[model samples]
Target: MKTHLYKMLLAAGIILFSISSCKKFGDTNIDPTRSSNMDPSVQLTTAQLRFSGDLNVNERTSFMMTMPLVQHIAGSYSNRWGGIYFNSPNVMGVLWEDSYGSDLVNIIDAVKRTTDVAAQSNLNAVCRIMKVYSFARMTDLYGDIPYSEAGLGIKAKFDTQAEIYDSFFRELTAASVQLNTARDAVKGDIFYNGDINAWKKFANSLHLRLAMRLVKINPTKAKTEAQLAFNAGVFTSNADICKTVHEDIQNPYEEVGKGNIKGNGVSASFFNGGAVPGRFTTPFLNQLNSTNDPRMKYMVKNYVDLPGGNPLNRIDITEPLLAVTGGYFGVNPGNYIWDDFKSAIAITVPGVGAYSALNNDQKAQPANFLLRFNAPFLHLTYAEVELLLAEATFRFGATFGGTASSHYQKGIEAAMLQLSLFPGGPTIPSTEINAFLQGNALIAGRELELINTQLWITLFLNGPEAYANWRRSGFPVLTPGTNAEEPGESLTIPRRFEYPYTEEEQNRVNFEKVLPALGGVDSWNGRVWWDKL
Candidate 1:
């Protein structure tokens, strides 16, 4: 009941921010009903929800572009940009457009409004941490972006990824250190409910995440930050995972799915009641199917198109993989066309008769299966932190803590266990999880590939982060099983998305300066600064 009220209040706060956002800003523009000195709490709620809960950016940047680029999903009308390497500048630009247009504006205002006010110190500290979280995602997406001058509601110049990352480390360090639990708790903190300690841990964990990103470009700095974050403490358990709480607010308008703070944007990106947006690629499913993974039931199930063609019914059909294509969960990309896919998965069982399965388990999306509306947007997880620790310990050794194998086991368990947080989400039996862990131990030579492949699995819904990690650690070696002359495959996937299309016209001089770094063309083929490896 308290959670419900908070959602109502946060929704109201978002409405307030939206009013200011939708209106013109300047001396002449004023909202008399709204306070001249509105509470920074309002802006914080607005920023958090908009950043993690926005459907527009989730759909365009994550669902459409990054997910398929990393091949977690593929072969849908919406995924042409990433799936087949079709270039769509509009899709690539949505995160920049959405963030600058709304999310950044509010968060920046929150940071500025509370900056030297002693009473709002804890609030200010939290906002600073959020600022790093928000900006880190943006900078990671586009190599050099308008950071310092961003959110001033004007055309701003750009900053290199190096400058932006340096600021992230500084901000995270200060915010985690500045958090004072003795002070008054911050209101409207939907992530932690004003738990300053949790916020501290999250800051350090996030610091660790950003540090690992520096490995390819600057291993020395990476080692230093990882050790610093470790000594300061990171997430110790699932209770410490940094995530925003959400309500299963029925989206009144999903096709245009933004502005609803209570609905989960990541899930909404996959929510097409009348149609399946995409299918899990065979290479991805092989990661589970090849191992007889216990989580298979949680992630994959068969779908049948009934005789009446009554929009794909969910069923428990699991026996035809080896019978058809020598054991693969999904049809080959070569057979992605419907007619080809139909014959590939089509089979005649005695009791079941003749029926064709949908391309992948995600055809069950209309029923809110894996992509539940209330599922929390997992920003940072203990599982992810542990996995990173495992990799760091493997590379940099004891300074990062614990044996690589021990951390690897904890990470796998945590990843499987965390699924229970989803409403009606599947739960693997303890025996199964244990058996799977026992079967797969982190052996010496394959440590990097094994750790990173797990990272890819853990990053299911958060597409952009998965895409970035895939670029950083070339794991699980995705393939079309061909020479694969396309940009995104074995070693050289498309490195970055093109800059926002309007930047050429809106911020021309500054935009022109970055193009030379992109090899004289604003193409996705260009690598970002940290993509040096």
Candidate 2:
């Protein structure tokens, strides 16, 4: 499901290959005409596509690693346990390549193309906003990164995480102002579709998110930026949420799910035949089950035991081969002793399935609700904004004209309504929503814990954000995976991903220079600058 942007990239790749092939072996003369310049509009489109694709790839990568580390899901037989236990370097490297190589570089190129052009001032502002978003994610994941000198040639050096965060605050603030002043509309903006006002909101919303990250480390700066973001206007409702809608291009999550089921991608351990490699974790399911959260049914599917036939063993069948109760079972995180397919199928109830899988519903035919190929890839949501505002009100006592309770309820309501966007998602009745909200009132003393936990639940499938918040807030105290205490590794959950091996091999000098700041070792135990108490 490639889009026009992807086709352009493909064509460019082919053209480059052809030009290289035409050059005689060891030819000394370089062809000046063999240029690869694109117009600002084309470059902007490419950047937007790359950014959206990077988000999808990041989400999939996190599902295999951080998702388990945070106990959202657990592996049954595969090396996913290695991820939960902090032993997966290859998985972490994908995120580095996608963000730096694909996302950031394209955004940088687009921003460069639009610079000094009066007509493209808004486009330039949009590019800057995207660049900040990309760089923020990179710094958040790994302490120091190639920021200031990134996307330039080989001699690029790493910028300290603090420096990167400072630039993010400045860039977002400037971009917000520029967006407000520029009257020109941006072209090729897939996220907001030329809506300068929406882009402004997104810029400020992203600013708010980055500011909150500094709450523990720099309260003064956090308060300042948070207030700035409020004045600039962040997301106020679902209409203001930032997402890239899937059109000609398929959702990356859907592709990942298909590959997993086909045994060609990350092993998810769902009953796709043979041995199950992973399943939802007990803690994750328990939280939703106990709360009677309507989203549970929308987000997960009960394990169905089938009599076997097709090799793919697709789980999205309309009619179950076998029906049973208590089929939805979650594995305990860190416990690798559980048998795979055998254990999942060992059901006592006559007509009940034994284990649950993350939702693989096919009620809407080609669109699989949560796993739909055309599902919107969300960046920021009104729900998150409301929750963050609630936290700001509770922690810093910023006057937002409402108490934390009001913001919390608004967040919950927005989250519930947000799920309805899925094609075949459950209709969360007003009754269930009200019941959950009433029963889960934010107590004055335990407001932080409740807010963070609810944020965790709302940010499902958003592993990086959830992991970052958990690191910062330390709410709903989670236990390390069973194998976390393995020899030579720290028992604590990983604070950051180690730098990719390519950096060590190709940019050894610059990489070594940053080692001292990373505790003189590129290891997962090293914390980023903002992950402070």
Candidate 3:
């Protein structure tokens, strides 16, 4: 967890200024300094750090909630079940805090600071792009939010989801145009490192994602915006993917690990220690196994051996390890439940070995290999762009000069390439990748479903986007797990998380105004405006 040099310098400078000002000031009649100023680059850097941290936090939280709702993993206990069943308001509130309290606020301040600096136009454009990205994510998660007038000291008004999306498109468009006219390089851009062109590509790529999200609710607008984004030039390759580099800041996963490890030594990276030794869902493993997806090996760890020596050393050796017998079984969602501290091994069926979870070979290492400290916080990727293009071409007759299959193949290739970034992660050989593409070709009748399902798989570790895609596209149809706590409620998957409770108490007027549009009360099943399906 190395601190950034700039952060250290900034802190030292602040302390020095405070001491020097204290020594010099004795003038009551002459007005003491009332104005404060910050370098736009410093503001940009702070905003980028806050935004990336928020994104990581959001993704990690979503893994416990939406990932299981979509059946990517299974909950083994009552508390773990909260995420799946939408029973934990406090646990879900972090998403709201991260987006609004941190990223959105810092980004607005950055925009204000950068506005008048012509030399900092590139940084200003990046700020605008990030503001749109942050707001779009907020609207997607909570429906109407404080967007148009959010972050101002005055009482803010909530904007409709449609209005927010419209503003996102306009902001991205304006940012892209501003980027094109940039005269100076950007600094403190954690995602793109002063590359204005890459920032432009990010803006357009994000626009495409936002546009496609509107497809089900507003097909005409979706098609038009998608085309505009395409014409504006989205990611051209994996090289153009936007992600924050982690050279100095500590990874959020490392922080989670520190708070969650118990005497058993199971890393919190394995489901944040919610469900003992969290196991992948049966459906998720089955999809990979059936497709012979090479990614499965990298993403999942077989329970062949346990760290700190085998706890089952005394068990009879007649029965084979579960990995040997059944080849790494995932817990079937809702099939079994138990209290925490109950051995994960005890729940396993005979000859199936202990349930498989994420690989923990690097658990003792400084940075978890699978969840590396230095791993980039992905914002956009060429893989996603190509997949979206494949869908757009098929649905809108988009003239990107390629067939759906070509875009699909490129997407698969890029996704495979992207995984190489994980420290000590597995690499899929070219032959295996080609075989996967050959077997999983986009058939004419089921192209949309197949493409979106693959998108779901590729979007692993990117939970919010995956959840949004699942909502809008309705692909990879998953059955909601039965929850005993909410037995009277239907098992339909939640459409969106409820607004944070603080909003109701603190921002009562605005919160109340938005509640009717959110189905008179904030409930998990209430769908956002773009979620027409």
Candidate 4:
């Protein structure tokens, strides 16, 4: 009765979160808080938690679309939108809907409530940075969006991507300065627990990321902002990684998979049924195995899970071929859908156990993985910031700070070491890491490709960001999936997702205003402003 009652309560929580998440904010993001007494700290916590755990958004946007789109993982029906480059309307527009409707509504209101209040000043600054982050993610994927008048209860016209990028730099600059230890501590901050300095570092580090996106469009401005962020002190070590720490909850897969619980979305989405998780992509495995990357063993393994949503139903299994092959394998994107998934597992090779899936630690399989419910999901990391610094230094000059090669090494090393942040996560043997590093030292001529490829590898599970980086930096060049796919859409990987098809009908007047910039039509082929050809 106790267990049953607890599950019932959790189910109720998930349902509420799902229903509330779907609430429309009308023409633009109408302020969620009409009452004056509404607490901004509560709002901050709400936005942070929802942003991280909104499986509806993460699963569709990251897990389904971007992950497979980038060849990180594939082979399930869940991955087709991106894995095979199909143009699904809801899949393309879900991020826009959730951000404007719920996540943005809360954080925008939180900033309004806390702005200039002495006790809430630090909180306000954090909200400001988060606001930039939410909007940045929006623009990175769908460029030239409704920004200036959004959430103002007016018909919102699209803002050019250049204008949006300007706001990102400006807001990040102000927020980083506004964060001060002398001010009152922040409340409801999941990333840093009210630590003003950490938030400050995160803001500056994020500034570096957004700046790097401009390498193709405007190198001068990118150089300026990148150097400014480096001087302002971005994350210098693993301790400063900006990630969301989720609550350790009962039935995390059950609760979070349903979209209400405060748990890791990546984990929940990847292991939705806890029976068949998507396989590591063949291209991804090649990157690891070819280099004898030590992270391979930690990345994927064989597991045979009985048909159930409970992780406990999974049986530990291994592949004898791992030693010779140096890793387990995955099908090409879109090669194995629902029926193939069943057949593949049923007729597994004699020596290879069951099909390959993400390692036990990443999946959170009970005794095998206490890391599940509470594993910290990566947002921005020291690894990413260091790599950006490496890229910036390589592109511009030494003014951005350390030598590109040195930062490149630091970035790679940080990525290997930081996996331990996950409960029982990999502590890559230093000997192995050092060996990989020495063997793959930065070659002079191919600096750009090598640096961004490392960035691609480090950005394993965060699909949207990976997609953005790939578009902007053009690293680890991916080929379009060869599986039979939806015909009308671009056979090549899409450069950008079109605006929600509803925008054409519902907000036709305002929507049509941005069409000229979109080459007179709302299509993925029309590139974002920063995404220069």
TM-score of every candidate relative to the true structure: 0.87, 0.81, 0.81, 0.88
lDDT tens digits, residues 1-533, model 2? 24653554554334333333433332111221223575555445554544444433444455556666777766534425333464666667766754454445557767777787888899889999988887776678778888888766445788888888899989999988887444777766667778988988999999988888988889899888898898888899999988755542222233321111111122121222344334567777788788777767666653232321221334443234124334345666665424232322232333444434222221111113544434555678899889988998998885754788999999988888888765555668888899989888899799988888888877765667778888878876887666543432447778887877777876778889988877799988888888875
Report, for every candidate in turn, its global Cα lDDT versus the true structure.
0.73, 0.64, 0.64, 0.74
Q: Residues 1-533, candidate 1, lDDT per residue (tens digit)?
A: 45654764556455545654553343111221333676787678877877657777777888777877777876555665676666677888878766776657667778888898899999999999988888888888788888888765556778888999999999999888889988767977878878999999999999999899988999999999999998899999988998866667534333332556567776666654444456676767878877777776676654453221111234445555335655444533322324133333666655678756544432322223456667788999999999999999998987766899999999999999888777777677889999999999998899999999999989887888898888777776776322233343323356787876677766788889888878898878788888775
Error of 3 at 402 (Å): 1.4
Clashes of 4: 1
Name the top TM-score candidate.
4
C-alpha RMSD of each candidate structure in angstroms: 4.4, 6.3, 7.6, 5.0
lDDT of 2 at 185: 72
C-alpha-based local distance difference test score of model 2? 0.64
Error of 3 at 421 (Å): 1.4
Model 3's alpha-carbon lDDT is 0.64
Model 3: ten consecutive residues of lowest lDDT: 257-266
Question: Against the true structure, whose lDDT is highest?
Answer: 4
Q: What is the lDDT of residue 445 in candidate 4?
A: 92
**Pairs clashing within candidate 4:** 29-151
